[model samples]
Target: SSLTDKIKLQEEDKSENKKIKSFEELEKETRESSLKTLDDYFKFISELDRNDWFGVFVNAISSRFDPHTNYMAPDDKERFDVSISGKFEGIGARLQKKNDFTEITELISGGPAWRGKELEPGDVILKVAQGDGEPVDISGMRLDNVVKKIKGPKGTEVRLTVKKVDGTIKVISLIRDMVETEETYAKSSVVERNGVKYGIIYLPKFYIDFENKDSRDAGKDVAIEVERLKQQGVSGIIMDVRDNGGGSLKTAVDITGLFIEQGPVVQIKSAGTKKEVLYDRDAKVQWDGPLVVMVNNFSASASEILAAAIQDYKRGIVIGSKQTYGKGTVQNVIDLNQFVRGNTVGDLGALKTTTQKFYRINGGSTQLEGVASDVIMPDRYSHINIGERDLENAMPWSKIDAAPYDTWKKQDNFEKALQNSKSRMALNEHFQLIEKNAKWTKERKDAAVYSLKLDEFKKEQEKIEAESKTFKPITDYQNDLKFKPIPEDEVVMQKDESFKEKRERWFESLSKDIYVEEALNVLDDLQAKPVTKGEINLKKKGVKSK
Candidate 1:
């Protein structure tokens, strides 16, 4: 993956050979032209005639395939470090390539960008400016450079002209700072239904930095959280692994050990070799109580590893919409700087290569076919048909022999109880509401004619607003959105069909969360069972219901 080879091939083909010489040459040109820091460096780089700066990134990353990985060039090295550390001196917001514009995905909570009160998800930034003059139109600009321009020092302000979700245009100004907590971790909450209490833990991502032996580890912390909930006397625990794109392999093994007493968590079969077993070291079951795990299309890797282990051990019930992210490959960062001595590329970053695919003890590979849940929930992603199944180079799903564990066997009738619970839920009001919402979401997602004309847009927005009135907003999204408490117009609410319309809008409005409701029901079942014979000696506590 040499730049010379790429450039030579381009030249021989008589195609546009747009490639920078070396980071040194590029920086020399920038300095000779009087460019200084990141802002100047990026502005200068933006002037270069290259559409696929992705190539430059790829080459730079390849250097990491060996520890000698050095980009040699100063600017590229800075950018590389930021991406890996997941820390950047900028507004805490995620910008995505959306319809020829960098759309704001979500304002990271507690970030300076989110504090601006003007930036929001679905807002599109049309222009960026450091000063008050005419803004630099970033339309069609490379995503990397566009991001570089927006990120700056803690006190420096970056102005952004944006198109809001309401289809109005405005300018938002925000100062920047470093982002903490690179990887999302698991968080827990309590839920109650019919007087039964349940503990819910939402795991956003599995991250373990073995390179930096943390003073505190996420996996151990999560295990502690589970134990705390058990002490609180939850009837059941629901581990939510939705959108968890995974991190450390070792951490996944350690986390799974908390559920199963002592057994292999995941079996790794590398390139036609013997299968290697990763076993639990703790020999302690943190919470052997009634358990369920939640997953979605985005849960993969370490997330899959934990999920598969739980399922294989029959330690918990896997619940959610279909399969997970189906990413079971392990990647190691190789540093090229270490290998290619005297090469100018500083720490050439790293090359993340897929080394092995992991499988459950039962022989199922969480590759293309992610771990199938014990119960399925309705999701818009189900109909859209995206994931490992759609990818070209995706690995195929397979199975292996199941591993042995002997904890949940005591609750042999759990499946029958679960089936009975599911049947009851299908006829429940909350489940029906979620079904209606799912249908509504499918319609909106499938709509082909999304428009901005006031009448048309307002009609759509009004419909959504009306549907949202059925249930209180989940969490504090309304306040986060800076929703103002405008005086209610009874006449307006009456004149519009929004209020009277069915309150079952799906993706946009979670009027009824059937999965959560069902989960609560399961919790109730766990509670209905008599307290263990030995548990009566302890003081009793009344259960809280929601």
Candidate 2:
């Protein structure tokens, strides 16, 4: 029976919507089973109008906004509950449709496909098969059905014929496994320059499983990694928290504990409730070394919390854009069946209502005023500004009593060193490139009208290109789509130096990104000061003469 029909029958039983009988009505409605075949499914789909189809899709995915949230339609929920979980598993890769073809956007890092080493981003999957027979072309197929066909039990093999970007085709086989979330653990690396090493820990996301209470969480994993990095003699560490959407709150505090000796990491303030201060255990310090956190506009939720705490306690330098996504509010998933009881309209889907607001240890809410960067850099989002501050229903920025903690002592000549670095960056080739791109982007964004007339549009585009050609190019001269904004490149190397065209030149130039180069330079300056009486001295710098 359709979900709507079930609700209709229940509503008729009690002429009023607020009054639903007892647990029996709820249990009986929830336990209702569906008996339908593949043909029946398609027949039902074919009968639906455009609006109905869209409504069905919306109803199917509505409850998945939260990590633990889910909405199971009758037909789909049956397969998940009755059957095995591993069958809906394959090489564990996230695929997406771009233009008209299915392309691999991200590899599961350590999954079967990643281990095969054949699949990569931008590779188009042309066909799939079970054995060494003819492959089936799955072009123009729906993404869900395509995934369903590819996924199966563990140890089972599947073959994929993929087409490279250069049009070359090859076949590769991979075994399936029930993908585990823990497999995406914290990864760490070290970068060394001029005898000073800085550990780079890239946390993809904060994750914790609710079912397995004993499993090692992200906080515990990060603590272990930090200890290992300290053992390797790293002078400092860069906690790169980019694109991390956030996970368990418990892990957030645990992760913060690694750096902070003891203090409140974050404060939770809600309506008509006592403020709660979540403190780090004063157990031991993993690495209280000089710290720098790298974040972008996409850095959100728990990412903002970690960055805010470090900033509040003056424990680290926050480096990135002007700010991050201001998502300070915390939400609680209230199962409608629990609170609303019998007064719900069908499965009004669990309400993910916002309950509490998170604040930095210093009492500043991270809502609108996302942790500001100490030093801002040129990013694509530099010019295009839009964040939580520019939202309609966004909460106001406020603060409470500040927490007491020793501020991370400013390194001698820190400001002078940063200014000198910025000066050098302004004169850098890559910085100029980004600046030009930003200006051009702003103009395009502010353009009043677009022309469809071929001649007029081409003429305008050519004019823009001619003006841009005067500036020195960054990296190399490539026929990228961005150049199409103007029309042509003028091959003008009148003032600046131009190098011979070599693939290695592009690779080597990008290998030392201007932003990363500046970051490394800062790290170098920071490493020169000797640890005397737990205080830094710039004059007695341990400079190595070549």
Candidate 3:
């Protein structure tokens, strides 16, 4: 039943003078409701044609090899392409189903919808029309079907009849165009601590356009961001790949090359082939200063590669969760249409199958065992089962002969800096609370059974909620740090209000991030300093005197 239905049922029960449901009666009703839902789902599945069943069967077969191997239908393939490429031809607005209506969540900056300034976030989409075609009332329609009706080839027209936030109905016309998902790209910010500036580059994924060589890729964009930071005279850089689930392998190698001199980034191995080492032949170091890479359990594949390479070379300190997502296998999408000559059967879609496995330059596979952080930090998922190891059919961890690579020796205080971070993490109260919360979360997750009786359930939930209230400070805690956009981003933000809002929100989060504060502290420790306290004080006095 829908939420509204459930609420109406409760109201009806209250209006009618009826005895409260007994535990057995409630349990029987709950079972009947669940069985009804299942029956409806099976009925829908029974109505599916052979093509849909064939796709499901194919996916089931492919998944048997590994969890990552799967089939993509035509529409699914389109979505996959957009995700990796970070661009799509559409109305450029994100939508969510709010009850029976589709609400606009966000308008992609620089896209037609944003440029028009007619459709805004919170506007409920009522009807959709293709060019001058008849409008179709989409009330209670599936969100995906609504999206299909709205998205089209570039240069086409999409007319949306939306109910505005002010309770006014208006028809907005927008020409569908190539919309780039800004969050998918690399972005950077500058922060100052103790009279030294540091750069923070957040790469959500190793995105690339396989069809377009000259397009923006994570590697190129990160290098650009690094150069921008260099121009700002930053003393250190923090590469934040936390929650990044990985993307292109080449982009990972390219991004890693920005920090170190020419070296092997990662090694690849096929089923029956010798290992192939991907080398960064470019000797030009974009940011050779003190470096730190931030990651969490969601960071996988390309993210692991970058972190592992940096760790192996002693290029940077990896901080955050105990380990990354541990996905080492590589996949290649094979277009199934290529096999048929002059095919008439609609698009057969593509198959993403594991082709090879990637290992760190140190020759250790980030499969079941991901890259362990140099300085482990406490997070909510600390005690939870996560990463590739959690998957039943995940690949095994292995090691081969270590690739010949030289460790970076520029920072003499590397060990000292790591120790300082570990000491700080040990003593931090916020982190301690976070660790406690993680244990509590794991305990709650393990205690799956719950009382279904209203009074008993309420009491149980109240007890849990009361305990959780103790950890509220973990979310409320904020560090006294300021993060600002670079001049280039600032200029862009000034022209685009939506972009400005997004950057400001990012800045707000950064200000509250204790992890970022600690990262900067580590960067400070990694700096080459005077031998003695007197000399450091003397240098500071001399600068003040000047």
Candidate 4:
């Protein structure tokens, strides 16, 4: 009950509801909207059958305990499985239902569509045509129906009328293929500054391919990357989990094992049971050098576990944002069909109920107060209401007995490095603009209801835009890095054309990463500070402005 603290929102008096003076006009519109809402609900109910309502009832009951606990129907279970497997047969682009069209949000690396290079994120799909056949306008269509139209058997072709982010229209054809989500996997690159090389590992998500178990492994892959960096004689390591939406818990524990020699990775406590400490008993440390973990508001669950463990151990400097996403619970999929017997009417799905809560080795639950960052940064989500505390009826934060562990053996100069970085960040113009923009965004969100008149609305919108325009070129920051793919990956990329382009794009992004540059700066300072004989012997790495 105390895993998430409730946010205290300052309430306005009821008198604020009477802002509009025209009561008669409001009453007239309210009746018309009431009928329209009823019509919409009726249409929604008309589309449901027996299983739909059954799933709804179970989910409604499940969600009462917390938001994470929910019942998944048959179709929902299949989709969940697909998401975990990270494999599907489609055009390999993630689509979201925008106002009237399906917008491409992200493209799977090495997929047929990504290799085509004709589509990009923010492009709107207006129509889908199968193999030169008559095109069907998909604007305003249901997302599932639109997906069905775009997907086909392998070897089939689908053409899309795409409205680009620049507002240009183009027709692009792509062959249907089984898409493997390469972006979810761990990738690494080498960055050089001040005569020292740093290894940067960007883990988008702690992905584990369950359907094809042998196909991918997050921990094993990361370990291999660390070994590759070690061969290059890297001075420090930076694990970037900024946007990672966590996945496999087992993988998270295993990945943490790669850092420390042997110790507890995390603690798990099931309801009505004793706590169990998951340990790395093998006494193997993959990268014993200086380490840093980067996280933002979106990093959660398994990501928090790794970051928390590292922080608790003082094994690395945790940077970015006020805190990580506060999700510290584990869920178990319960098959509802198992409970049904004796001529079960139809197929029941499963319930992914929260079964256990986790705790950091230092005894803090990352439920409400996520893993707090040591170095807070100015980011876009800083002013947003998007955390566990913002959720209705979220679990509160709590504490447990601290697990038996020792601080990192190489702990040295962390405080010095943190203070030095804070000083540098205070003078950074880009970060200053970010903080200003965050204030502006909060003010706009607080305004809430806006003027309905076209002229007034336009004036307000233009004013907001003009104020925000001062912070353009947020992506202009760049730092030089001698990035090289692992020897084994270079060999594979040589043969795979799509993989080569994807790797190139990844390198380009790294060049423009302001966060990565700052991380290296911290690592450099940590190394420069005096420490235990072997902890840090190098000089301060240089930072150059373009």
On the 0 to 100 scale, the lDDT of residue 157 in model 4 is 96
Please state the error at residue 332 of candidate 3 in Å: 1.0
Ranking the candidates on lDDT from highest down gives 3, 4, 2, 1
- What root-mean-square deviation over C-alphas does model 2 reach? 18.4
In order, candidate lDDTs are: 0.61, 0.61, 0.80, 0.76
Regions of candidate 2 where Cα sits further than 4 Å from its true position: 1-183, 339-348, 390-392, 409-417, 446-448, 457-512, 528-546
The digit string of per-residue lDDT tens for model 2 on 57-86 reads 764465344222334333344444332222
Any runs in candidate 1 off by more than 4 Å, and if so which?
1-46, 49-80, 91-139, 149-178, 182-187, 190-197, 212-214, 344-349, 386-392, 400-407, 428-517, 527-546
* Candidate number of the best lDDT: 3
Ranking by TM-score: 4, 3, 1, 2
Give me candidate 4's TM-score against the actual structure. Answer: 0.77
- True-vs-predicted CA distance for residue 336, candidate 3, Å: 2.4
lDDT comparing candidate 3 with the true structure: 0.80
In TM-score terms, candidate 2 sits at: 0.60
lDDT of 3 by residue, 1-546 (tens): 122223334556755566666556656765675565456546655776887778779976887788889898897798877655557889778786656789885566557886786886557898788998856667756566789899999999988877664333567899998887776789999998667889999987788877789999999999999999999999999999986778889999999899899989999999989999999999988888899999988788899999999999999999999998899998989999999999999899999999999888988898878999999998877986676776657778898878999999888999998887777776666777778888887777567476756667656755775887787676566666789999999999989997898688778778877788778878888888623433111111111100
Q: After superposition, how far is residue 248 of candidate 2 from its true place, in Å?
A: 2.1
lDDT-best of 2 and 4? 4
Worst 10 residues of 3 by lDDT: 537-546
Please say which candidate is ahead in TM-score: 1 or 4.
4
